[model samples]
Target: MWKLSVACAVLCSVSSVAHSQSNVLLYGIIDEGVQFNSNAGGNRQYYLASGELNGSRWGVRGSEDLGSGLKALFVLENGFDVNTGKLGQGGLEFGRRAYVGLSSGLGTVTLGRQYDSVVDFVGLLEAGDQWAGYLGAHPADNDNFNNTNRVNNAVKYTSRSLGGFTFGGMYSLGGIAGDTTRNQIWSFGAGYANGPLVLGAAYLNVRNPNVSFYGSGGTVAPTTGGVPGSNFGSSPVISGYASARTLQVIGAGAAYTFGASTFGALYSNTRFKGLGDASSGPVSARGISGSATLNNVEVNFKYQFTPALLVGAEYVYTKGSGPDGVGDVSYHQGALGIDYFLSKRTDIYAVAAFQKASGTDSSGKPAVASLSQITPSSTDRQTALRLAIRHKF
Candidate 1:
């Protein structure tokens, strides 16, 4: 009896120790609101819209203490449309972010599906997290720096902070069996934040982006008949096409606080290359483009009206230039928002935004008619109003 009691005590003690060393937590946010857009156009006429303020999501995260200053962590988050109750990210159950990795005093590394460093670092600088996700993301988020949008067989690494500066990198495998060069991507970025100043820069290169865009279920439709701007070019085969696209983006933002108010500004530029078919056409149609450049500038002001009330306003301008013979377009956006805090983790907000476009279409005339057809129309001015309540735990 004594021996049996001792064994039982030992087992219980071991189990307790193990349990104390590990922990798992369940957390999530659900934000829903009513939105109205002035110009939705045609049969898609604007009505009540959901997920205008924030995406509705739930996630499970956990961590385990593995002895001396080292730990293992994981996060599995999902995004859904509350109105339709449908999953985001192409129907994947855990599409937002699903990754596991290790962390130590030096840095942290994660594997599985995860956001690239560019998106992780620079996305925060955008006004209202780039309100035009699929519809308005620059380059349609094909660069992966817009948000938690891209994830497929990826590995990411982030370094510890040193003097308020940190760096990160990520790579995604194309998952092509037996073929290594099909649709691979790699990115690197660094950020620095201290006091009232924050700055970040990043670069990403997608090899064989043509295959990846068409085959990997990107936003661009393959049946659209040739690229967006080319002159009646035939649709490129998904496999036979070869175009190496590279994206280089640089951004900087700074905010200064004075009493109960803060003022900020941001700027970014994106350049694209290797987008034309040289084998079958004139060199003018081939090679990198000087017109694919996009530039953005924004200014913002936020004031704390009271202990629990905050008001903010922002204005943004974006310009896109096609190739030499193509055309140039510009967009302007303005937004005003107010937030009332009910508690530390709960709040209600109201925001209004307007966007206008200006440029010429492919026919060399005013592109006003094609404004609604374009993703981020430089002509289709729109006004949106949203009221939402959010709770975070």
Candidate 2:
């Protein structure tokens, strides 16, 4: 009888412990606002949109304690347009992030679609999580660090912080049959935050990025005819070739807090390479970006008027250059916002931004085209304002 009682007690204890270690939580946010763009060109229009203060999303996250400082964790998040009730992220169901991984004292490794290391690190360094996202993001989000955009078919590893420092890396397989080298992308980055000081940097490279998708219905073929000094006549008809594109980015930022205010500055540079033809075929039109370079500089300040009220402002400048005979373009943007905390997990806010473009496109072409238009022949200035309420639960 004694032995049986002891066995029964042990079994009960095991079951209780297992139950305690498992958890599932549901959380989501809905943010919507009416935006008015001053220079919407053909028509200055007012429209409803999502993700004013943050990306509107819903997700389920869970973790199971495996005992001895280990756990299994997963997150499935989805982004949607509140106005249109449509899914974001290229129309995929879990466009924001969907991944599973194991975590321990050493670090965490996740698999599936996720943000690249550069984006994960440098993105946070930006003011207001890259200025409240898409509308405030850097031109083309060309440098992942500013946008934290997601990567597909990725395997990522993040190391535990040691003395306020952490590092991470990611590799995205092309997954293309018979041509493994096509569309492959990889990145690595590190960050350190101690007290009021933070610093970060990263590098990224992608093979054969499909630029045709930049505008229109994606039918335009990638072109090598743009290479400078190529014998191809003006506006040459050349199909895009299988070429590698590399982006090396270095960034640093610092912030200081005094009383209820915080101020900071950030700077970064990105360089493009491998644009030329490797086969020596007309030099493949590389380095048309003449003597000019791409540079971004920003200054920001945030003030907490009260425990529940916060205000922030930022200014950013971007410049792109093309080689001699090629034109150079520049962009200036300013943003102001205010947030009111209804509670720790919920808030209401308003944000406004204005941008002006004067310069050439990435190709160093003339500024006759506007960067904000995303399409050719559009104007060079845009303004947007948003008001939203958000909650996290």
Model 1 over residues 1-393: C-alpha lDDT tens digits? 999999999999999998999998888766767665555542223444445445677889998999899999999988777778888655668877889999999899999777766676776665565333212333233334455346467889999999999999988887779977556778888888887777777766655454442223223334334433222122110111223243445666666678898777767775545535432112232343332555777787888889899888877676766555333666676778888989988888887766666674222335331211122222356666677777777
Highest lDDT scorer: 2
All predictions: root-mean-square deviation over Cα?
5.5, 6.2
Candidate 2: how large is its RMSD?
6.2
Off by over 4 Å in 2: 1-15, 128-131, 146-148, 177-180, 211-244, 276-293, 323-327, 363-365, 368-377
For residue 55, model 2's alpha carbon misses the true position, in angstroms, by: 1.2
TM-score of each: 0.80, 0.80
**Quality of model 1 by C-alpha lDDT:** 0.60
Q: Write the per-residue lDDT of candidate 2 for residues 213-245, one digit (tens) a residue.
A: 111111233345562222111211011112224
